[model samples]
Target: MASGNVSSVTEFILLGLTEQPELQLPLFFIFLGVYVITMLGNLGLLILIGLNPHLHTPMYFFLFNLSFVDLCYSSAITPRMLISFVKENVISYGECMTQLYFFCFFVIDECYLLTAMAIDRYVAICKPLLYRVTMSNQMCFMLIMGTYMMGSSGAIAHTVCMLRLTFCDGNIIDHFMCDGPPLFQLSCTSTNVNKVVVFTIVGINVLVSSVTIFISYTSIISTILQISSTKGRSKAFSTCSFHIIAVSLFFGSAAFMYLKPSSTGSVNQDKVSTVFYTIMGPMMNPFIYSLRNKDVHVALHKALKKRMFF
Candidate 1:
């Protein structure tokens, strides 16, 4: 439909993680282990939260959503990556678009969701008396729904814009998956709309979410400082530390990757940055949340004890 000098690029060959034959087996097992851990940790968290009554709260509810996101996020890239390590890492145009769509959707959802979680924490810590009134079930549900809508909308915008471009040039996506930038690179057309959409979406999502986090943490820090007791401050800081770490890892990597000038950063550099959010962030999420959050630790302990006794 779209007019371009280049007409068709049916399938693409993915340049996987490595081409060094000697490193294949070791890398395969390492990723296999990472995937297994990601599945078990996230799945276990979800199940523990679902079964345990004590863990039924706004915090855990959002956490449950986060676990689900991490699970889907990892599945979107990791399984294919695993397979690629073993065999040919080739994907069709249709399949590549589908992967890009879902991957974009979940990744964007996480940005919004994490911002919402920060707001929730801000309410709980800074405005404890109004926590219930502020982060009510209805409100949480609405926030989650809004996040999903934003994610879907962004994904659709990117995917639709991508579809309009004629990929008549080259189809060699020089990375593990059909990432947004690499996909854009393969287009035979000018890709003006694609560039605009990418810039607008990335700018809006990152700017909005980052601003929300900054505001939330500002209030939170003020509240923490007002507490004269060192122990109290430490306790509050500890609770929020995990979230801050997660946010830093997720948003920092995203900002670095998406906010950079494409003309300045090479495609390979972009791909490397993408690996932080796509692979590293997901891998680190459960470890960060479970190990750092006291509530999750208690829930895990209680669940294990109950299972052993019963």
Candidate 2:
């Protein structure tokens, strides 16, 4: 029954964040601005990383990919969401699934990419002598490949499970996007197995990535403590502090959206959480990295100067 299942509902109406008549226009403009900034920020970062020879290290390599993922991640959800703020927000089944798959793919990619960055930091600080050996160009390429592999596998599994279920519960999604939980709730068929598998995979992605980051930071802190110069310690901590902030913001929203019990949070709260991770996360990341990183700032200044002269 699961394998042969076909959707009875061909489209879904997204209820959006607020049903109030007055709030719709304001919200649409706000998210449109967000989407615009997200595009500029990520694109600018990508250009900065690509053009600068000094930034061609393992850390910037990860940041480059991170910016790219954030670009795709926001693009996958924000435009459709902005549309919902202004109109009836109808999405066909195929479009919904496509959005969901890309959303899941980029999100999972970010999770493991952050984990890989943490490992890079760990090696950079804890084993400075072996940093080059440990995170070589080939090694970095492989880690990035592994991140995408995980992302593809995770998204495929979730989308496949959703594909096997038929939706029949009035076709109104109470959230702004085509997320897994709302779709699961809309399914008329038994979703016991789907829920179990989906939740299990979510747990694995969040837990494994977070735990790896924690352990890496723990070792990094320990290493930083042993450094004799306070200046050196503070410099090391500053680099890590920004990454920590970005990780916290992203994972904090993710936890609220996915890990909590369904009975505890309102649909509106879920909408807000989804907005943060999907829109705000991407928009804020470029600022977080570029503002905090001296290397990025210097590269941007140089790029600006060259363009100014040319």
For candidate 1, report its TM-score.
0.95
Across 261-289, the per-residue lDDT of candidate 1 in tens digits comes to 87787766776678788877877887887
Q: Which stretches of candidate 2 lie over 4 Å from their true place?
A: 1-7
Instruction: Give per-model TM-scores.
Output: 0.95, 0.96
Q: Model 2, residue 143: displacement in angstroms?
A: 0.6
What is the Cα-based lDDT of residue 231 in candidate 1? 99
- Model 1 clash pairs are 6-168, 7-168
Model 2 C-alpha lDDT per residue in residues 1-310, reported as the tens digit of each score: 1223453888889888889989999988988998999999999999999999999999999999999999999989988888888889999999999988999999999999989999999999999999999999999999999999999999999899889998866789988889998898899988888878777988999999999999999999999999999999999998898899889988999988888986798888888888888889999999988896889989988988998999
The count of residue-pair clashes in candidate 2 stands at 0
Best by lDDT: 2
Against the true structure, candidate 2 reaches a TM-score of: 0.96
* Cα lDDT over the full model 1: 0.86
